[model samples]
Target: TDLNWPEEPIYKEYREAIKAKYQIDRLMKKRPNSRISIFAKIQAAEENLAQSQAGENNSDFDEEIPF
Candidate 1:
């Protein structure tokens, strides 16, 4: 099916409100003192460390902005 699209941005507030509601729903579902396995914690830590190291390595390279 062919679709007609808006040339300018639209439904900005509706989109943001939907995102906010999703975040609120996610936060409400999270339990305090949730149990996580030690191995899972280690894996998460390793992933975070890897991401930070990757970012640090990329810091030497400059990124170009379209604007």
Candidate 2:
């Protein structure tokens, strides 16, 4: 019996990071009155996501949870 659960997405760390990056980018784009330009934020997010995907930093960003 293989103890490793290949079917579980959570078992893959990169998947979780990608999911978080997508959610953060989506939220950042939705803010209407943010101090920084939406385009800038998006660009920053892209860079951050790239860094994360490269197995660098994995910092958590603020995301709104739908109730």
Candidate 3:
């Protein structure tokens, strides 16, 4: 069975949305004395970190399983 799958529209939409959100957050950070913007950037960074960690964990788990 082929494990490769084509990318779906929903996934593309999600990727685009994440990219746009991050860009907005990045621009917000450039504004001095913008506490609200800073907070938003921090939140976005934390969310990205959590997602990265989860992906790493899943990859490790996959490697541990005997095929």
Off by over 4 Å in 3: 1-33, 61-67
Clash pairs detected, candidate 1: none
Over 4 Å off, model 2: 1-36, 56-67
Q: Write the per-residue lDDT of candidate 2 for residues 1-67, one digit (tens) a residue.
A: 2335456565557666665867866776767656558778999999998987766334433344454
CA lDDT, every model vs. true structure: 0.67, 0.66, 0.75
Q: Candidate 3 residues 1-67, lDDT tens each?
A: 2235456544767656765867866776666668778889999999999999989977877778899
Residue pairs in collision within model 3: none
Clashing pairs in 2: none
Q: Which lDDT value does model 2 have at 62?
A: 30
Task: Please tell me which predicted candidate would have the highest lDDT against the true structure.
Answer: 3
TM-score of candidate 3 relative to the true fold: 0.41
Scored by TM-score, the top model is 3
The 10 consecutive residues of candidate 3 with the worst lDDT sum are 1-10
Ranking by TM-score: 3, 1, 2
Q: TM-score for all predictions?
A: 0.36, 0.30, 0.41
Give the candidates in order of lDDT, highest first.
3, 1, 2
Clashes of 3: 0
